[model samples]
Target: MTTISNTERGAAKVMNRTDLTQRLVARLHKDEAVVGGIGHTNWDLWASGQRPQNFYMLGSMGLAAPIALGVAVAQPDRMVFALEGDGSLLMQVGALATIATVEPANLCVIVWDNEAFHITGGQKSLTATGADIVAMARGAGLTNSTWAADEAHFESLVDEALGGTTGPRLIAARIDMTKPAGTTDRDPVKIRLNFMSGIAPPDKEG
Candidate 1:
């Protein structure tokens, strides 16, 4: 895989988070796992569709990627996607480096960079000023990191990642600070059990 440089682009495409989430959900046919971050990220994922393969985080600043990493490592045959917000990702940026070090081939990280902690108070984040998440991921040794230029480009990246490519890819997108349309059901135990059953091998699933 090749590293995508921020300097090589004009500006990242600004897209609605829910639209992207819906597009992603529509394309999930291989039982690929999705780990949604706290707040809007997970809210939109839950809204997109309550698939058993989707894990929604309720309360956490930046555990999405870490949890997805564990799932990817544990199920090497399954593709895992982690959806995170720019602010939350900034809170635990070190996870990117750890993900790079482990290098799970089926892992894909998607960062929604609205440039603010929208859930909290709409405070500006470093990305709003000058931080480039794709660049940061690349620096952390995730060479397959790239900024989606537009919705079409984002779809292309998603297709490539889910096509069984050997990658621990990171795809960052510029999103708007709109409220998500739905809420994740608040049942942690049920979520865990359903996800476990969804990902288990056919024969292993009782």
Candidate 2:
């Protein structure tokens, strides 16, 4: 009956995404870590345009999962997580099937299912119940998935999901995107160029 309540009923910690991202990134600080998503931080990282340790998502919301998959496959020793949004995941739902096949233990997919595209406007999305997320991921063949209703539970889930278990895990979180962090303005052309700099084909001419 309640929509997007901070229920805090799970064992995972509820965070404002960037905070969680900072926490997780801190955990893997020493290693080659990559956080792919669509938004301000992403655009910032993309504008910086560094490779190996930096990957900014360009077009498509759901593609971050697949992108992280490739990064995990190509660089098996690195740490990769997808800071995905619920709206974006709705765009590329099928890519999840590939995730199950790849099964990169180091891969962690965190969906900040705020029920809207924060970067755009806090408009309504398909995640009216937050049901669209957890249900879809479970059905996509991914195991070790959980949803966090509060901050404490989210932290715990992160620990369990990333502790030592084999992954392809999804953490669906419902949040309120009202606390403005920043804008979603980025140099798209520059992002494309920077992105290409990192993963250019061997035979491709620049």
Candidate 3:
């Protein structure tokens, strides 16, 4: 495992999810696949710009990383990203260990840790008190996991993950309690078809 710098959660800057989402979208030049978790995470992804390569999880809470893992494993040539909330991630924490075991070099999981379940009446989550996601990720055997120190640091980490040949990188960012920019189109069929077309090879696209 490569040794990347780990930022302490307390020392990390609190940022807005919408801003960070836009920043991440702006950096994707190569048709990378991004699986956005339910609610706010997918809303920001939709607002960022509707890339056909983006998959929005409508009802599922904790399947973003697992879905992205499947995409990463299937499309080894392309980069894959999973945008998940801290609460959702905790719900499927075992995915971290599964990802570590599979070791997909093209996979990168980014957790938006606002420390609350923003969509569900903003209830405080485990992260609000003492849950450390990065530490949990490390314990799950994802050695490349780390807390994003700030927005700039987050971008640099994204760049490194995109360029480097490593397995299952994890980045946790402390986010603010800001609302998402927009709501995603709720057409599950259209979302699935578009994402399928987006990730397909040119010859396979309709």
The model with the greatest lDDT is 3
Clashes of each: 0, 10, 0
lDDT of 1 by residue, 18-97 (tens): 99999888999999999999999999999998899999888877999999999999899999999999999999999999
Model 2 sits at a Cα RMSD from the real structure of 6.0
Clashing pairs in 2: 11-153, 12-152, 12-153, 12-154, 13-151, 13-153, 13-154, 13-155, 14-150, 14-151
Give the 10-residue window scoring lowest on summed lDDT in candidate 2: 1-10
Tell me how far candidate 1 lies from the true structure as C-alpha RMSD in angstroms.
2.6
What's the lDDT for candidate 1?
0.89
lDDT of 3 at 110: 97
Ranking by TM-score: 3, 1, 2
If ranked by lDDT, best first, what sequence of candidates would result? 3, 1, 2
- The reply for model 3, stretches above 4 Å from the true place, is 1-4
The list of candidate 2 runs beyond 4 A from truth reads 1-15, 40-52, 183-206
Compared with the true structure, all predictions reach lDDT values of 0.89, 0.64, 0.94
> Against the true structure, what is each candidate's TM-score?
0.94, 0.73, 0.96
lDDT of 2 by residue, 1-206 (tens): 12232333243344565565555554554344466677643643334334445566766657888887887787665556777778888888887777877788878787877777767767778876445677677788886666775665666666655563576788777665645344334566675565555445446646
Q: Which regions of candidate 1 fall more than 4 Å away from where they truly are?
A: 1-10
